[model samples]
Target: MPDAASTRAAPTASTASSTTLAIGFEGSANKISVGVARADGTILANPRETYVTPPGTGFLPRETAKHHRDVVVELARRALEEAKASMRDVDAVCFTRGPGMGAPLTTAAACARTLALLFDKPLVGVNHCVAHIEMGRLVTGARDPVVLYASGGNTQVIAYNERRYRIFGETIDIAVGNMLDRFARVCGLSNDPAPGYNIEQEAKKGTKFIEGPYGVKGMDVNLSGILTFYETYAKEHLGAGEVTVADLCMSMQETVFSMLVEITERAMAHTNAKDVLIVGGVGCNLRLQEMMAIMASERGGKLYGLDEDGRMDDRFCIDNGAMIAYTGLLQYENGETTPLEKTWCTQRFRTDEVLVTWRSEAVKRPASCEPPTV
Candidate 1:
């Protein structure tokens, strides 16, 4: 953490600028990021560091936390420097409060709490998933789109209703990204950048698609069955020259992404929502965006987060400090702030647990889908 007293002299009230700024810390998972943003939704700077393990291995919590603690302060300083701001210029401090590894979450919360206490700024504890959604909305200008929140730890179809981002459908077993990572391990894929990114690249070269298990039950999807099938048969197929890694990757992507698109379309039909917004780290995949765009266009709707080339900018798509900062600023503008006593981090924060005070108006369900009169 940057020392408020030693680094930069505190700005007096007479010297403080009128611009409202907030700094955010994020280390919910392997990545530790710091960001600075203005009240007008402009992200001044976002710097992040990822803790990547070797091939066929996943990042453990202890090592990930250690990595976060080591780089958070430097990243914070870099963010502030890139933003050309100081602690005294910031009006609030924000941190991701949950739905992540406990150790890494605590590491970020500790840095955030220290900064908030030292600078006497209000602390805003943002939910990790909500931050993703809000950031997607900010970037794409989608007001009431049906959001597909997909990441390593989460996979859900969501929409705003009654002061909450209600979960319309979600994974019942492992997350989509988790399945990809585990499958990549089975295939001995490198985790240098990201396992899923490598899988996406490999899938592009696949001419054959091996059949995999698809487990979609009503509003929920299950990926563990598919993962288990692949794990059990991958080695045999490779040894027998029946399937290549690229073919297996294509099979996995097709099966899981189809399930995701199915649930998202179902949610949109149920909610009568026309706009579809994709968020989270896995949302950076071009294939997922392309599938979603096709679904939206079929319904006479539009897709957010994709440019003319069906590609997404990774800045807002992946986990980052800017999302937390921007979402926290939204909360702060709504007169919501986490007090020092209530600023604890958690490992399991749900999306619907938040009362979205900023968006007070309820999304009215279409009468065609509403219940009949009593």
Candidate 2:
């Protein structure tokens, strides 16, 4: 738990040319990342720490928050040192406000409030999903692209609609990343780096595709069924040599990633947008990137993510405080600062809940790609 302290008026950003610096804190889940970013889209520093649970265990909320509390001060110091900037240079402080583990989100929020008061800087509460999209656009030069946000706790196909990042599709149950992590545990894979990464490695050697229950209900997906069926199949067939971990990994990824890409393509079609940005923890998957690239090229568009250059790594793609900082800069510059009394984190913030005040201009829709209205 973070110690609470508070109060101050945030500095206002009057123009785009103003070189405002922001320090961000993120502990939405098992990973806690501290980072600094400039309004000009420059990443000053991004230092992170991830909690690794045992092979068959999941990361508990309280434990993860404890981890964040133990390392936040040290991480913040290191991030500032790497960026060659001091707290005095920061104009605002940002932290993940939600769509994450409750305890962890609160831990980061409390820390952010403390820092904001200490430095007399503006405090900004950033939605985790919007942070991912803003960071993707900042890192890759994508202009108003349809976003596919995939992570441990969230899976949403989003696009700008009516002044908001509308969620055209999302998971009805557990997220695809959670599905993969659970599967990895079932297969006795290591969760050291990330279960998803290890599962991708196993998927690469797959010789067969054991078809599991594929869930694609219109725009929404249900990954819970996939995990259930796959677990049962593994238990029933692994000892009999009928199925292997490789096949299961490949099958699960192929099935779920295809659903994610499909929903993203639908969003693109609906919005007539040509660029698609893949973000979040699970977006680092190479197989998903390949499928998405193929789909985008066929539609005369391009996919803007995955580790090809830097999308797959922790620096830009994975969960990080930099994403929060970068996004908070946009909001703070747009006058979206949070009051200390109202600086609370949520565990269920939706992508569409964000008003997206910064991106005011609408993207031009292609005539040929106009969505078919009912």
Candidate 3:
């Protein structure tokens, strides 16, 4: 990690240009999202490429690496084009440094470094988890709120404290999104593109809600056992064509999301934070949003749910470049940028490890310029 003094400070407000462009790269999980943004947090262009690993087969690192190296160039080019800009116009290059698959991170770092060298710009590394939280704040304007992050590789309840963000609670095992994805595979859901989105749709049609284990050790949680029980029950009973996949999906959502709601509510009470924000891919669930809404209302606090239309919008969610770029920009502004010599990726980077120096400076405009919907 680079110390604060080692970073190159952002240009002072007086010297900062109005149109400084930042390019961000996100190659975590199976998706590659590239973003271009202005200094003031306006998204210019956002494009993503998703890679598919065959169902039932394990994640092959080398295969994933190859996918990243092959697809990122086109994705980056398209994103730049969408912004009506080129690589030469970019002022900085940002890439997700870690808390992801090592191969994918390496590929992203290499691509970002090449772009930085080619364009003669600064290369900044970003943490994927922090980018999610920063996106939440950017869109919702919920300052110093407790964050509930549920994703393929992470399940954490975080709060900004002291100089760094602390993980009040997190998963001891598999992440919530991974559990959902695994269940989707077991239930024969589509592996094409978005598996989680497919599962959410299936869950909507479900009427029955089955119970599962709810592991709550203090603030941390575990969903693997619940998934195991669901899988076993489905195999033993549903193999005979008894239970519908919709029912299974509904039950899974109810059990897992309820656990999330419980922990988030508890964290709010413990921290006394007046606002609650939810991030991560699983944060898009309607049921999860409803539950959090109820909890926030009951506690007399606001809940900023980052659905498709929140301040940041879905463009920031689902692993896009804007959030990464924005977070990278924050890191750069705060003098936290790392040198190329010491940068590395961690498959399991904890949220508490990094300090939270970024602050919400302004309320975002409405998601769109159109009149508010009735």
Candidates in order, TM-scores: namely 0.93, 0.92, 0.87
Error of 1 at 11 (Å): 32
Candidate 2 local lDDT, 228-298, one digit each (tens): 99999999999999888999888888888888887888878777777788888888877888888899989
Candidate with the greatest TM-score versus the true structure: 1
Model 1 lDDT, residue 136, Cα: 84
Model 1 agreement with the true structure over 94-165: per-residue lDDT tens digits: 999999999999999999999988989999999999999888877777778999999999999998876788
Model 1 alpha-carbon drift over 4 Å, by segment = 1-18, 367-374
lDDT of each: 0.86, 0.82, 0.75
Cα lDDT of model 3 by residue, 40-112, tens digit:
6667777777777666433556787788789889878877877888888887899988788889888888888
Candidate 2 has which clashing residue pairs, if any? 10-122, 307-312
Worst 10 residues of 1 by lDDT: 4-13
Task: Report lDDT (Cα) of residue 11, candidate 2.
Answer: 23
Q: How many backbone clashes does candidate 3 have?
A: 2
Give candidate 3 misplaced runs (Cα > 4 Å).
1-17, 54-59, 306-312, 360-374
